[model samples]
Target: MYSDYHVHTNYSDDSTYLMEDVIKDAIKMKMDEICFTDHVDYGIKKDWDEGPIEYLYGQPQVNVDYPKYFKEIESLRKKYPKITIRQGMEFGVQVHTIPRYQKLYEQYDFDFIILSIHQVNDQEFWTQDYQKEKSQQEYIEGYYQEMLNVVKKYKNYSVLGHLDLMTRYDEIGNYPFEKVKSIITEILKTVIQDGKGIEINTSSHRYGLKDSTPSRDILKLYKELGGKIITIGSDSHKPEHLGAYIDEAKELLKEIGFDSFCTFEKMKPIFHQL
Candidate 1:
């Protein structure tokens, strides 16, 4: 079945695509399943109720309004019964933020959750705050090290979102993959051993990147390590971005020796043929 497992709506601070509008677009795209993985970066943003609304990059920054978000999801599920809609969130978890995530995990019954490292020590990558004052090796290694540390402590997620995400914000250029290969291997092994997976985020195409978000090398290494749980997503935040490049992502996975991709329900993986 065709599916886009990572999506964003207005519930996310960085997006303004309305929830119902996104669902309608997914249905028009003939998507069989769609999961709303909105952004919730604990270290960089605040919850809707925690305090006054703040602004980031010209957008009002606020985490998902849980009470209203779930209410709307239920309403939409009934309003549009054709597509299989799932509730999910993208938690931007840092090593120090594990406790907050664990507590949030116990409070919700999400169908899926994407573990992401949007920042480290409250410093964001897009702004280059985390990468400044460090050599390429230092920043890259630090990013992977944080991932390793977080996965070692957090188990409430279904898959790691955009495994090599820091590269997207690196203004210099793609660093040598071999330099961070061992650490990435360790991260993947930990994720696989913990019964977790990684997502092939299609946003790389939108960004005009030379490879997939995690890069082909990482995908190959994951296969070599016998790590099989995989999902594909547009990581869309706009109407034009919705369900973009999904077919190409599937083909790339097939070329990499992966025969199936996954969708999630109640935090469990359900595989589908490529």
Candidate 2:
């Protein structure tokens, strides 16, 4: 039940946390399980062996080194038998990147895959490259529309990571949820119908947000719409962030009327009582 489903290691370009060190930290935190959901944004990042690598924001911008990543995970499992480790990757999928993700899914025996929209049309949100020029409605609509399209075409993921992720990068403050209610409803409906779930990312607390990553409103809507599967993650990239606010998140879910939360193994969900 105490599982951190979203974590990053040195394999992800933006992280420098060693995989072994992450395992040790999880064990110390009394975490029952942890998954290595490192980044793999094909449209924006290159695979480790895919020719010459380039640097971005102080690190070599490269996807997971598949061979080393899997090898180390296997090694760590045996070395740290007290804590369960699962293999996963965060695919920052865009509409055009679906094919690449599908190929990756076929190549690896992943326990989980977080389908995230870190960027759309190869432009990143954190950098404001995707939202700078477009009007608020245009960019908001564009973001959700791209997500809807991605969910419609992509089926390899276990859950949608940080459903309202754009809010994190939005410098304009909270955009009215009612304004994009219809599209959000469509996106959630598609996810529910496809048997996928969403995660309540606790990183919102670290970011000092007004609510959880998806916001309480979205979580309630998902419940009202008959969506069952949900997972909670700290989205940790550092030791201090590991397993952060997980208990608080579970409390929040209980407040929202969710009696159970999920963990994945071989891409199948296992529910635990809240």
Assess every candidate by TM-score.
0.98, 0.98
How much lDDT does each candidate structure score? Answer: 0.92, 0.92
Candidate 2 matches the true fold with a TM-score of 0.98
Give candidate 2 regions above 4 Å deviation: none
| Per-residue accuracy of model 1 over 159-222 as CA lDDT, tens digit each | 9999999878988898999988989999999999999999999999989888898899999999
Candidate 1 clashes between residue pairs 3 or more apart in a chain or in different chains: none
Q: What local lDDT score does residue 21 receive in model 2, on the 0 to 100 scale?
A: 99
Candidate 2 residue-wise lDDT, 17-130, digit = tens: 999999988988888999999999988889988889987666677899998999999999999999999999999999998888999899989999899999988898988999
What lDDT is reached at residue 185 by model 2? Answer: 95
The residue-level lDDT of candidate 1 at 133 comes to 96
Clashes of each: 0, 0
Q: Please give the range of 10 consecutive residues that has the lowest summed lDDT in model 1.
A: 54-63
